[model samples]
Target: MDAILRAAGEVLGTELSEPVDLGGSPRTVVLRCRTASGGSVVVKKYGTEPDDLRAFTAEAAGLSLRLAGPELLGVDDSIPLLVMEDLGSAPTLADVLLGNDPQAALDGLSAWARGLGRLAVASVHRRADLAALSAGYGMGVPSWDEEPWLLRHAAEFPAALAGIGVEAPPELAGELERIAATGANEYLAFTPGDTCPDNNLLTPDGLRLIDFESACYLPVFMTAAYCRMPFATCWCVFTLPAGLAEKIEETYRTEVVEAYPQLVEDEIWQPGIRRAVALWTVYLTTNLIPRMAKDEPAHRTRRPVPTLRQLLRHRWETASTLEEFPAFAETMRLLLRDVAGDWDVPPLPGYPAFGDFG
Candidate 1:
């Protein structure tokens, strides 16, 4: 912990004190440290391993973009650490969503979606700049939208289904290939990559996003899926109240329309969102199918959370409704019918905060 703080301190040209451990993944050590001026800053240090360095580079590159996240304070390439503005004690969107107050959760959700939309609109013109920044960082981690990453995930879905003794539909591959092209050329924007609920702080100033390890540019619909599915990649899975999601989505759409006017049309917007939903559903399926043999929480500690089986079932149910991707829809049905039918998990439930609304 001292080493991490020392690296940050060296970058900031001061001695840091009062180090508090902020939990991190295997690849990182995060600390909230006090500076000489009695102010707090976050020190994030990445390991020297390949993937860890990639994450560090992406984060440094991302924060330097000066987008909606915490401000970039200092960086040390030798240890690949970042000293950033401390957002301080603010309740995160995840905290609000997981709590008992419905009004607070509603406000958090609306602000998160709208804030993301504005972030998207604001970031539309900075794609080349971000690319240059990542290149300068030298980790060579390609942005999600720049690479055919969704296609890679899509390709793995059939094999994952086969592992569970299910056959892939004949036309599923073709549908996935076509859908993979959605945000590759247009309608692109920068994203923190993992906009899970826990990563979004509902600060008094507004929604402040953090966790830029997987940050990159991606399709706008890819993010809209979060508002549509309401936290698509997050462990904080819960159904938003009926009509509330649409309102949230519209709030986002209203802002992003400034960058891509074509998205103002439902013809373009709705279909794109469906394609993203299908891809994300498939992405989750591929990642989780290998582990669903034993039921586990989506997160280690967070509770009232859905089990792996339940989350997959919920995703399949939603993805099956896509009219544009017939084979993909059929595949979701096949998974729902042939694979997940005997999982013995309960149906996914609404957010605890919204439980009373129903």
Candidate 2:
């Protein structure tokens, strides 16, 4: 912490005070500092790695050009720190959503959507800058769809099924097999890979997107898709006050379609949303199982063994067969077949193209 303060003070040309801990994920330690010129700043310290430094720099540059986040005061390479305007007053979108107030949640979601739209439009012409930041960063687009991490969810199916005290219908496995057979890629626009409500800061003035550690250029659907699962979970769990869920969903759907007219059709939106949900389910399930095993062993008996089983069951019950989520299911199926070898599965549709956006 002292090292961070000293480094930040040098970079900001100021005398920094002792660091204050703002405990959260990734173990962030913050400091309140004053420049020699009497300007106040906040510094955040994370691990020292080239990728981490690059993300900080890219976020600083991206936010500096827009009104979407805190100002980038400066960056210190020595301590791998970021100095910026102190936004202690800002509340994360997660906080607002958890309030369970319909109006507040809708407002926060609207703000988040608009902020994402701004980022996407602004990035269209900044390809060069984005390219440079992504170069050799080991954080570019995934070459294949079936990421190994996703298999962790597949492994959890047995546990989740047992926990739920139900056997997955044979149809569920069939759908999984079908999803593994179709491989396709469609480019939309860039988005932060982890654009959850928790990553957005809601200030009195407006919403400020935070945490660019997972930022990358990808299909615009990636944002809406990645974001939908949390929104769905939140809606499902809270039941919204009155008919607010319908209104919020309408608002989100309309805004997303208006912002990217190319995906107004179900053919595009359906697949995108499904892929987003399935992938996110796998992500959440995988993380949940390990955490459950360690911190909540008592609950483990009720927890899903194979994370994907719960997700698959949920998908089958809530959504139509994989036939309904064509593109997304196909992508998953293809990825699985590639990784796990061929399995007996019914024929599936060919990948559909929404034309080239690039």
Candidate 3:
């Protein structure tokens, strides 16, 4: 620790104070250090494991991307230490979801949408840079046909639901294939991989995303659709109220146009967004089934997960909002009918007042 801090200080041209440990994976260490000049910088150190080193190296490459991450102060690629500008102790969107400030939550959501939109627009032509970050890490852009997560999980559809007594329609299988095909061919953009509220900090300047250990380039609609649902990739799985969801989607779409006006004429704006939502819904639901069946959170990536009953309720409610996709609606209706008794318990305690979150 002392040697690394000394190295970081030498790189930053300053004396560093004691570090504050910020919890992260077992293989990574995050810290905040105050400089002799009173400014603070963040440092992330990787463990000696091979996977950790790969993730650390990839994150360093990701943080170097100008628009997607914080200002990089210094980096020692060998030890895989990164010194970056401090984003401060701003409350994450997750904090807002658990707090009483509805308006602040909305502002944070809008800021997050706009920030991601700006990043996607800026990186549209920077595939070389993203590819460099992904080299040897196997985390780069995934084609529709090559997306392991979608392919792995979507195959479990209809069949997996049957164990819980919900039979998915044959039409749904064809729809999933169609959605995946379209997703592979259109609206490619850079993605931070983890779009959780905690990863996106509402900094004073704007919203900034952190933790790029899994950054990649993917279709822009995939992200749009991911956020539209209950943040499926993240641990914070609660339904974003209807009005709030619409507003955030509008804000994101508006920024996409504002960032890349040419997209409007290319006819790749709204329709692509709709397609992404439908496709991602099918993709997310497929992943959600195993967790729902086992009565566990989809991913144990974070703490304070909703209970099994709450998880199902949130999934059903979020799926209910997908009326535009009749296939998803039918799938959800079947699951809800079959699993009604199992999820009969009330929601998890203190499940925030989303009714007023709009």
Candidate 4:
């Protein structure tokens, strides 16, 4: 804690005091503090491990891009800390979805979708910057040309499935292999590596993204697809009322086409988006199972991983809505049946539990 204040002071050129722990994993220290001048700021200090340093650098690189996010106040690579203006005390959309009125939650979701779309448009001319940000980074969003990290995860999926008592079928194994080989390069754009609602704030201006530890340039469809599924957040998978998701997609699509008309061609945009969504869904869903089922030190700091039954139920419900992908739907059906066994599943919570409204 002392180290964080000292780092903040060094970066801000003022003695920072009165820190409130903002919570973080083992590799991070997030604090909300007050400068000597009485201004509020957030101080994020990353550990010195190779992966940790890379994550911090990637975050700083991401902030350098003119995406829809918090203002980048000051960054120090040596201390690996970022000091920035606090975005106020508004609760995140995740909190709103858990406890606010349905309309308010819907409003926040709309803002998040629109914010991401704007980010896509803003990144249209930042190709060189995005490449520089990604160069030599230890970890980043998986893309076609560079994907060693995702390949490692693919290799572990079969064992992850086995840990939960489900035998991996040959077809499932083959699908995983196929996904590893596929890439979504043509539609690359800046993506918030982690699109969970927890990483954004519901300010009066709209949703403002906070963390960029995981942000990178990836297929624009990755964000669009994740906005519909709980792939990024994993814990909170609220079922939107019918047609609401499509409306949100349209909001995003309109913004992108306005920025880059060349991408609107039917052959390029439609199939690329759908295929990207499917590939991402498969990768995320497979990767989440083992992590969600087992408790680890990292999971201890965050929300408890949902039970296998809960995840299977969520997956099944999500798959049912994707009727266009019958094969994937069939796979979910098979997995759901295996997971159901004889136990009665619990009911999912109703939408809009708490948080900001206006």
lDDT of 3 by residue, 12-115 (tens): 88988879987767888888998998889998877766657656656766777776677888877666677888889887888777677778877777888878
Residue-wise lDDT of candidate 1 within 190-261, one digit each (tens)?
A: 889899889999888889999999888888998998888877877888777789889988989998999999
Per-residue C-alpha lDDT of model 2 across residues 8-121, encoded as one tens digit per residue? 878877678745555433545666665566556777775545445555545544444443456777765455667888776576666665553546766786778777766676
- What C-alpha lDDT, on a 0 to 100 scale, does residue 32 get in candidate 4? 88
- By TM-score, highest first, what's the ranking? 1, 4, 3, 2
Residues 225-291, model 4: lDDT tens digits: 6665544445555456667777777777777776767666767666555655556555666766655
True-vs-predicted CA distance for residue 62, candidate 1, Å: 1.2
For residue 211, give model 3's deviation from the true position in Å.
1.9
- Full-model lDDT, candidate 4: 0.66
The better-scoring model by lDDT among 1 and 3 is: 1
| RMSD to native, candidate 2 | 10.7
TM-score of each: 0.95, 0.65, 0.75, 0.82
What's the count of clashing pairs in each model shown? 0, 18, 0, 5
Tell me, by TM-score, which candidate is best. Answer: 1
- In lDDT terms, which candidate is top? 1
What residue runs in model 1 are displaced by over 4 Å at the alpha carbon?
A: 140-146, 356-358
Q: For candidate 1, which ten residues in a row score worst on lDDT?
A: 138-147
